[model samples]
Target: MDHKQIPTEIDREVRIPFQGFYNTAHDNVFDMALEQINTDDSNDTVEVISMDNVEWTAVRLGYAQKYLAEIDKTLALNARFSRIIGQKDYAIGNDILLARVDCSKLVELHDAINADPARKAAWAYYVKEALTERPGFIPYFSAEVEDWGAFGTWDDAQIDCMLAFRGIELEIDETEIAMELMEYVDEKIWSSVIDPDQVPGHVNNKTETQLST
Candidate 1:
């Protein structure tokens, strides 16, 4: 695990008591990359957007409680066990059940909310106080986990046992795993792809290893 701690201010009102995360994608973040990669019709070009091939980043549009509850009441995708990728233990967390989620329906719900000018304005009021991203709301739920800290991580098959006998819990970033995840996103997804020359040498090496395999 990397010993470096990600700097974050934990706003209890916005974060604690385990309020769920609201996922969104910014056009400022993704559309430019889409334009960059789709400039040519080569074989390596992405014809369509899918979670598997593209290194897409999801926005944490703060803990918009009312909106999140409304969205959850309409969840269409079932959460499934996700294969934990990457080598950073700090970013991935330990002894946690990572759920692979598809937020297509979630995005659809947002679209419905957005279509109504009055509802969209009302929804914006709830999240305006928090740090928010906008323009593109391509919501996604990928590899989010609830963590129990200092607890041993599957060394003696404890995680498997928990899965078999007792169901896992779903909460966001009990140990600030989300913080590390965002850091990882900034470093790996954005920096490496958007501006390769600016990424550290070590990050490029790690990216190479991940791609080659």
Candidate 2:
């Protein structure tokens, strides 16, 4: 009796569900850390857990606005299993992770900074440049304004508050100040999950093509 092994070909078209947040590196780190923490927890029946007092620094307003927009878009586009537990509450459970930022805290920080007159002027200049010169910048700013509608308008007072918190003074040029602020925001809003050792088979095929060409 002869036995023949069946040939099999794995379909590479199937994509695995990717999880985690886009903004803030700490978010991913916290996710990994939480897994470890939950495994170590003695109580099995605990339904809710609060991880508070995670110190966060103020990022640039533009960056935060962009990051939030990206997150909202991603959530809307992707059909994922994750649930948004609360509209304004922050909580993380076994099957769910709720992330939220304290707008009031940010507002307070902004208020303290805007108390300085010189900083307020510098912030105004920066905002003007952002509005007129950078077309791409407007959407994110508009979204932020809409989000913060409940807290009043995104006027000079609000802009001054944000600038003041960054310890920015009126002596600095608007362009330079905007650049600095954007850099801070970029850091806060950029995050990724990369498996350095893993390379897709399609990548190898592309490299082979390049070599032949």
Candidate 3:
């Protein structure tokens, strides 16, 4: 599965559907994840095909804009994770993983560093020139804004589960990126049978990854 970029690519003018999100690593797990999460949503109507996360996110993100920015950035090249949850379960509230620096603020910081010509050259090299590309982690430069978030919907627990279930270690902090990774939870691991006594049990039980065909 292609991961370096999406099929539609990120467009400032065009809205990308849920399927357009890039899938670099776990292609097999994605379908299973989508099925599992859809079941969790309980859209039992036969007329309705599945949980519409694209629509869901669009609405949610729109409502969440007061807290969002025109652009947000994580200083690290890798996905950033923050707002740690210190609990025995450790799965709840994980959706609040987006600990990014607002790009406006980031720009100020960048400009501040660039004020010193010597520092600017060093910083430019560090940010732009010196960085090299490698396999599975090919580096790409972009002047384009990759994604805009209707941020602050899912908790970090929900956001991190994709990596957690697949043993993928990158912490996904972008709201849009995490939204695209809705399939992180393995269906066999998360239960379809809901017990009022244990929601966590439902989330982690060994169950079928897909409905019987």
Candidate 4:
């Protein structure tokens, strides 16, 4: 994939459905770590156009903001203090894996759907099964919003399962670029699943160079 595809801004006009948040590395050190993290050294074919900016049905938005500057600020802080942590099980709450993404665009989209009589009526009729079957449909993000409380109608552990299931989407203008950015982040974190050493750790408060090597 062309790393250059990732852009630095968001088109606020577009609204997207998002899943959760992910903490990703953005600097040269992180990039080098990612390269080393690839145990197979495989040249995988990364799809260019992603509707949700992720390859997974359940994408991890991972604390991503509408603006790249905000993301960079957080990454900088994390790197400065070497604050990255790890978990044995992808636990929810407090654990980075369980984090939720808050985007006004998604809130606005849901609101628009609620306000339109036809649109509001359509979700129940056509989207019931689809919504329930959404790769990880526990409604984690939806539950946080007051207006999205309608999803609470199906109250159950299914929501919890969805949270565990790591599938989510984020919609925005320049969606393809956004998707590329997400893919870039996932490459580093997901590698940890294969090789636990890739998970960022606070080893003696080590710097990025030490972590990458």
Candidate 5:
């Protein structure tokens, strides 16, 4: 929410579609922070990259991981309910049932794909290709390649390439968030929660309240 803190130089504006299957969807203009090098400056200017979407997703998944056991139990119950209704050929409450089926199937498919050596190799190759084709985001992927390689027996070179690609993607996402924040800052709407004028009063009140208690 602190817009001023967001670095805006490398961040660029993008148009996001609001809904699916709409010829004219609401346009959400946001900024993404990405790595860029400017040679036009008297000295070379290299900006640090960031990604808001990946950061947000990581935070959300981290929360989900914290409550994984609870999530597993809920998923289990949903799957059971789905099975029961499907066995009875009932359509009255099919939505949840269908959802459960889809979720379970997706999990099974993921596991199967992961376990397949051929599929894993294929995926790694695809990632490598993506990285090689996109050179702008090389530095970021270089940082992440080791982590990606640790997941499987993907070729070191291929994993490195993928990591390069991931870094670029991260930069793109960061630039977007940064740009959006910069706009708000430009409007003078961004400010610290505690104003300087309130600091002395806040400290005095805290001391007085502690003494009274």
Candidate 6:
């Protein structure tokens, strides 16, 4: 059994509560690799122009996300298991199920839309058709904006530390197994991708992993 074990070195993680995390993200304290532009800098400076670029990229990403969510893409993805924690007054056995799908396709589409100057008007037209009435533009845009600044400011160590945020009941870090799989995937496929969203579901009442009933 040990030889066949999954070998996830998960016990080393800190279980920060899930509380205050969203607020932290908003406060510029979740430590995401987001831009820290000084508005004091002239409005038309290159930095501000770059900021505009990031925002526009993020806006298009929102359209892609809206289009994809309607597809329920998880039908072609991976799954993870968990139990409820940091919840108040829960039942004795509160297990939760989660799944995620690779958004590589939409991510590539977003990039292509953002890159081609000729497509700029086309994507703007698409966004007006699909994403304006939706609720995800800001969050979606913020993520892209953060990723842009992250490329310049965030290092591997900082990213590793980012994996250690509060309200973080569980940590899923890379292991030998994940690395091998990722290497295989990269070798087999060359594509850009989007981050997955957690799809929570109720399971057969398996709460053994919970810290308490």
- For each candidate, the alpha-carbon lDDT, in order, equals 0.30, 0.32, 0.30, 0.32, 0.28, 0.27
lDDT of 2 by residue, 1-213 (tens): 111211122111111111223333424444434344334357453312223311122222223334334443422222222222211223332112222323343444445535667755565565555444354343345422223343333443444334332423323233332333444333332211122123221111111011000
> Which pairs in model 2 have colliding backbones?
110-161, 113-164
CA error at residue 6 for candidate 1, angstroms: 31
C-alpha lDDT of residue 78 in model 5? 27
Q: Please give the lDDT score at residue 127 for candidate 5.
A: 54
TM-scores, all candidates, are 0.22, 0.24, 0.24, 0.26, 0.20, 0.18
lDDT of 5 at 34: 21
Worst 10 residues of 3 by lDDT: 11-20
Candidates 3 and 6 compared: the better one by TM-score is 3
Question: Compared with the true structure, what per-residue lDDT tens digits does model 4 show for residues 1-213?
Answer: 133322223221211122223232322323433344443436653322222222221122222332232332332211112112233344552222222223233334445555777755654443344344466556443322233344323233333322222122121323343444655454424422432343344222111221110
Clashes of 2: 2
Name the candidate, 2 or 3, with the larger lDDT value: 2
lDDT (10s digit) by residue, model 3, range 1-213:
122222222211111111111232222234445455446346542311233212222222222221222112322322222221122332332112233333333333434544678654554444343224555455444211112112122223322221232121223334544444343323322333333243322233232221111
List of clashing residue pairs for candidate 1:
none
- Predicted structure 3: lDDT: 0.30
In candidate 2, residue 80 scores what lDDT?
22
Maximum-TM-score candidate: 4
Candidate 6 structure quality by residue, lDDT tens digits, 93-157:
22121223223322333345457776645544433443344564432222222233422233323
lDDT of 1 by residue, 15-105 (tens): 1122222122222333444444444556455433222333332221211222233333333334333322222343343222233334333
